[model samples]
Target: MHATEALRRLLEHCPELDRTHDLVRQFASMLDARDAAPLPDWLDHLAVSRLPALDGLAKAIREDQHAVVQGITTPFNSGVNEGRITDLKLQKRIMAGRAGVPLLRHRVILMAGLRRSYP
Candidate 1:
């Protein structure tokens, strides 16, 4: 059976999976059948309607790629690192920053080790 037909059968039996599987199956069939059957009129209309949003997304991706290539954007999870830094800042404030860096480092290390040992 064609991929589309198999997908239709699967979707009919398991509607809970949503349309993602059907879309993937349809895309694969489209790639394999190159110049085979044309898409239905409804799908063509939907694609036209979504073209602008897709183009914007493509543009954003290109800009992001350029930034990465130019070293303008650091490849790091700033959000996660910032959260850790914020926790460190809170620790410093609680101790009024009176603990030297070494003592602070030792405290953090001990806390992490205790968490791991207990957890």
Candidate 2:
């Protein structure tokens, strides 16, 4: 299902969760409406306050300058790394679930390193 619809379903199912989910759904709807255009002024302001480094980096990019913007606009994400770990777990499960902790740790580390080096 599309992200907006999925989010709507989730909100419908859990009406008492944190409000951030609703905000996210609204943001997604805005993006869909605008074809994922640049964030609107209000959203930009909110982002700037919440993430100063991103605001600074955006300013620099606007001025045709580049600099290390750590803590803002991370160059990589841990999602792929987490996925790799999950995949490793599944593979180990197929092998009678007998992989030792050390071997699993080594395999995950090696795979993460390789992914970073190649990707």
Estimate, for each residue in 25-118, the C-alpha lDDT of model 1 and write its tens digit.
Answer: 5545654554224334324433444455534544554556444233322333365557557657777888997989998887777656665697
Looking at candidate 2, the ten consecutive residues that score lowest on lDDT are: 65-74
The residue-by-residue lDDT of candidate 2 on 1-119, one tens digit each, is 99979877887887543244544565566544543333344345434544555456456644542222221234445767588978688657765767887887777787677778988
TM-score of each: 0.29, 0.30
TM-score of 1: 0.29
Point out where model 1 deviates above 4 Å.
1-76, 111-119
The lDDT values for all models are 0.55, 0.57
Which candidate has the highest lDDT of all?
2
* Cand. 1 Cα-lDDT: 0.55
Residue 49 of candidate 2: its Cα lDDT? 49
